[model samples]
Target: MKYSSILFAAALVFLAAGAAAAKVPAGLDRIEHIVVIYLENRSFDNLYALFPGADGPSARTRWAPQQDRTGKVYDLLPPVPDQRFPAALINAPFLIDQYVPQDAKTPDLVHRFYQNQLQINGGRNDRFAAWSDAGGLVMGFYDGRTTKLWAYAKKYTLADHFFQGAFGGSFLNHFWLVCACTPKYDDAPEAIRAKLDDQGQLISDGAITPDGFAVNTIQSRFQPHAASVTDEARLLPPVDLPTIGDSLSDKGISWAWYSGGWDDALAGKPAPSFQFHHQPFAYFSRYGDGSDERRLHLKDEAELYAAIAANRLPAVSFYKPLGIENQHPGYANITNGDNRAADLIDKIMQSRSWKSTLVIVTYDENGGFWDHVPPPKGDRWGPGTRVPALFISPFARKGYVDHTPYDTTSILKLIELRFKLKPLGSRDARAKAPLGALMLESK
Candidate 1:
């Protein structure tokens, strides 16, 4: 058959399958509120490798071997450097479950955009240690048995095949979660542009090398507070990107991005633990500091708690925890973050809106952790690595594991479908909604 005919056949098969799978469960329309609680940096295998029924790492599973910059496999993984820990004390790809206590912290690895591509290495997935600043620690895994969220997975719907929308750290993936598009800076100052080497890695000194990928971390030019002086170049300038919020508002639907420490951070308070880049809406002109949109939609996480108590939750909500509550390596540990998230869930369950709400719990990125499964083919930004996602609702299928191919944009797709809103006209336009086999009642 001609190539065009083959494509047409595939399209037909896809449409038929979708029609078969798409079921508007009874009472789905009664779900008036959708809450998305986005956590920080963890791969699915890193957190849910032993999840009861999810596709996670196993002893029988073939491990992706670590590769060196020279394309040679490491006989033994190297210790993460630039830390107080002795080189001999640490080894790459070690069972973190054995060493790090459930409450103890681990070193943060490099999960930057370019470095992740190097680690992915055209899907060989063997260069994690070679390209990461945290060395073999990049290959670490955890015991899900000790985590609270793991228990929650057994109670709700866990999606094992979900991936991060973009191939980068919290900064970019957060953008993908809210906007389903990468933030761009036109005419960026030469001083702040990522300097790259011939190998497409960011050069030691921050300049764009010829024909090299600008994958290194750069500072945002437009930070929330001018007094903050750390990693200024890492910030991206404010862009008028279209976001899910924009879409909802355009249709007169109510929504909010409730971020931890947002109010304190905007006030320039010290140690609010607010990450500027993590707040994607702040970068958009529509939600600038003094705008009515900012006041109405960009809210503190406390507001969400209050809304839950008052039974005034909006049609859509996205909640981001503060640094200490976010389950990020190096600065924070898994146990505390898991417990915090569980507490939030417990509160939601007790709230008045629980019966009419659908809660989605997921991470922003893999946080430089290793996973055995490769992400599906996607556009330039990503479908980076597998991350755990949970669908929690009164109507959600109990004790279920969803294997649908989804990414961060999938959340946006769900919101679009739920609100009958137009697409964001990016990857979200084509992203699959995680609605299959999740609801209790079927057509």
Candidate 2:
């Protein structure tokens, strides 16, 4: 071979060696089961604000003062509508437990896509209190160290810099959790399309964007949704994107989405808090109502327990708790939800799969709550505010605090890495898997 040809071959060898050296963290292949325990609506600051050795807030933390819609800075926070807070309060993050006990519920905040973007305020993260319908409550957080899950976190790995995938509420974030991409509503009616002000902030929240993206909550086209059968226009059109479930099934890997209240929802007697929009797979055409895949993969929360007890858990499982135990504000209290999550973890620890399983506990979104750290910019969709994400496994680094920048799709990336599956989109394609939190070469 010529000198140039030899040099080309040498360079190719060098590149290939580098790629091989960057393999998935050691011992990852041993994780046969990954359970993603997806809870609802809480920011990192809202839940883990007082966690030791984590990037939590303190009394001396500087806060960005909130500005009203007209760009006027607030001298005092607007009074909370519930009259639970003191009449006058400074414009900064406060301990919610000081007013409402950790066991109590608070009013829901506005967590729409456009509003979330506006609240982020170009990453300043100062508009939450201003844009929130619950007013000053947006800046409130609990002393999370008192929660039952805190003990689990102390025993495992806590990811302080993790973010939710999408820039909105549970609906879009749920879709991102499965697909790492936004759902489309290409021919949505104008009435439901969001109306934005000149500054690109939402004048009124809508289910679809002006450009035909479903960034907000909309009833699924499938059965068990709130929309009437005749109200086709009101329902979100069936999405065509491939989800993590699809990818796993294509590879003959077992997986299931076990949701609380799913069976009841199908029986047309859904709990009052059974949010139809939270079911991401129900909107996909492949999982259409009565589809065999739907029957096989979409299961009830009780099935998760049975599977755990029987050691019959799938390779990958996504578990969504019922609203009452999901830690969502407005209906769910933090204490009950935290206790439920701890109990679930306890049950899983006692299961046969415990030795080989990886359990990821995280929230769906910030739920319109405020956080100190701004999300790293990604695409037009999100990586919204910071949400609590933790790693629990025998292989997980004991009592470690992982500051690696990760989003909700990082969980999907972890699964993809373990299963050797291709990423569904650019978002998860670039997401850093959470393998760094695990012990390498344990075998």
Candidate 3:
């Protein structure tokens, strides 16, 4: 057997053993709702370097040292000025604590699919700077002491080993979050297909280039409207993949994907900040425009707040904030996203459903940020770079750290097991369910 196939088979065995060993918590059925608040960009180390008891980068802990293009380690990283706001950078990875003030945004880094693979560099993890557009900034870390979300982590369950499911950017990872599989464009046009070299690295401008890693970000030929043609590559064609949403519906379990600025974006409003690619359900056939499933399952963020207030949240809910509040570098700052998330958590806690709710706060992908730990060996797609995942519930072990390894598909696994739904038959089937000591009480 091929090496990768052997590894995959071994992984499946491990997952099966893990599932068999973990008994479903007795009171899991009492947890009637699962709320997934998905933020954007930032990696675990980028935002939680100081999170207590978590495996994070530090002078003593594993350090994410920067490397130049030539693979030489940089004693001190050079300044990476934002393309839009070149003057904002402070020349190095400065401590972004409460004392530093938090109005400005950092420049965005390249988090495309191929670039991530290059950064991972077969688990060497020393090529972040050599493969990045943001130079040494790829090795940056933040002080968790400044953030409200960090406080939430300290007060709740932080899964130190949680990772983004796929190996790419927000678009594909969002699909992984719901579907646990890569979106496919059968017989895609040559223009859209990534050009790869002998070693499988992306080829661009007649040469293999690390900077030309656009594996799946091409514009879709099918646009929502005429004006949407401006960036067709960004929109993926509608897919027919079955999602966790479909599974929930099959079991008659209530669910919704609440996204910020959904209505305006569908209306063809320019830069609506709705982020079309971020809406994974919108690209699925069942939830296509004008479909009844779309109307019932997809909603606006405002509706989420209303639902919380009215205590009418569904059994499964996924919330995506607007661009400015998403904590994505280049446009949004971490402070804004952290504060908004903290407030949202506060509101959720205030709701009557808090006692029965298990809220998961996580990110879509690493967003080109540096993390010291290498991702686990899974399939060709991933268990990508480590991202922060917080389990917030009345039953969650308070002030505890969960070291159990989990990918984005793990969320789907938990939901599937809890609702007695069939597996999606991809990573979700083999992924470890969030079981064991994560909960404080059984019954």
Candidate 4:
């Protein structure tokens, strides 16, 4: 009895010590600005497969053979429908630049909610080519070392294990970035709900689920948006849920969602390349047109640069480039977007706030690309396919590749921890913060 009592006390002491050691590192508090550059779809493997020191594919690695819907493994991958790629490619990851150079645009792959789940194939990650609209193009990747972003990665910290917070595409993942929860369309029409087979495989694609979750790309009902009043039945209603923007506002901290071509979109003269669904917060009631939140928080990309130049950037900033410069497949080529990103980083570095600022560059989702690393098992929404993320700050470890597993919600976690704000939802509350990259040393 005496020995047992002593052992219990020692265990308690050990746990207490661990708790103390887990406290937020002091250096994180020094960051005055948190800038999130949310780029368009590109998976870790899509852009960073050849990156040194990353868990990237190598010549010796064996890729999982793709299986068709009936479960037959393909000996040769299906031909890329547009004939942009070779017709007789084998069933494995290939260096895309060898055939279709990075400067040329490629056909966009199917990246909808149901299709993504189907392609993941219960985490085997072997059905991407079978389910992809772009066929074997899904298995293609670039030699990232040749890209401009790779140069910045070599000088900063690259997070090799980070994933998108949600499955599917930009619209849903953008919401996850702010709220860490799926948006709801509670009274959605039956016609819009996804039709699933008995095996839970998608028979037809949909913007909303049977139970009312908005999983696929859907237009917002607000003005300056793509949807009109006549399209109300299909559009997403004003979301009433709290977002990271709301939390920041409550504390009187400055923040903004800066998107390219915002001013033109509002004037009904939007650029041909402007995307409506990319503006996630515009769907919220608090940020309706003419509302103070809308006027003050939603601005043009030019404003972001002006703020940076003037050294009065907001405490939190989200910059979404125009579709033409966003690096999305089909619409934009990789080289143009790569140059734009490098330019943004150079401008940010010129700011006086650069010393105390942390810039996180990440993609919305994998864009239906094939990645060898299976995402960690998460909830129905996700911590989806691995996406390349980087930390560019003076405090970031120079030339380091951080392998800590994180998702889109990790951005929220970092914001909440630095400002002592409450988490917007369960996902962010439980998410592991990106302190491994932000902190000065191992915690």
> Which candidate leads the pack in lDDT?
4
Candidates in order: C-alpha RMSD to true structure? 5.8, 7.3, 4.8, 7.5
- The digit string of per-residue lDDT tens for model 1 on 1-443 reads 00113332443354344322123335567779999889989998888887876786666666668878998777777776645444553323456766677688888887877677767877767887887778778777887775777777788789989999988788778778877765555455577555555554556543221222233444345436546456555455566767889889988999999988877877777354566667778878888758899899999889988998898999999998888788888778887788778887888899888988888999999999878788898766678988999888887778999898999998888887777766664467688988763673552
User: What is the lDDT of every predicted structure here?
Assistant: 0.75, 0.84, 0.74, 0.85
Model 2 alpha-carbon drift over 4 Å, by segment: 1-23, 197-201, 227-230
| Clashes per model (N, Cα, C within 3 A) | 9, 0, 5, 0
* Candidate 2 lDDT over residue span 3-91, tens digit each: 11332244335434432212455678888899999999999988888888888767677657787877788998887878788888788
Residue-wise C-alpha lDDT for candidate 4, range 1-443, written one tens digit per residue: 00113322443354344322124557777888999998888989999988889988787766578989889999899889877688988998899888888888989988977778778887888999888988898989998777778988899899999999988998999999887767879799887888767666567778987667888988888877763436678888999877899989999999999999999999988898898989989989999978999999999999999999999899999999999899999898899888888888899898899988999999999998998888888777888888999999987878989999999999998998887777666667678998888655432
Identify the superior model by lDDT, candidate 1 or candidate 2: 2
> Against the true structure, candidate 3 has what lDDT?
0.74
Question: What TM-score, over all chains together, does every model reach?
Answer: 0.87, 0.92, 0.87, 0.93
Give the better candidate number (3 or 4) by TM-score: 4
Over the stretch 272-299, how does candidate 3's per-residue lDDT look in tens digits?
A: 4556667778778888778889889988
Q: What is candidate 3's CA lDDT for residue 398?
A: 84
Which is superior by TM-score, 1 or 2? 2
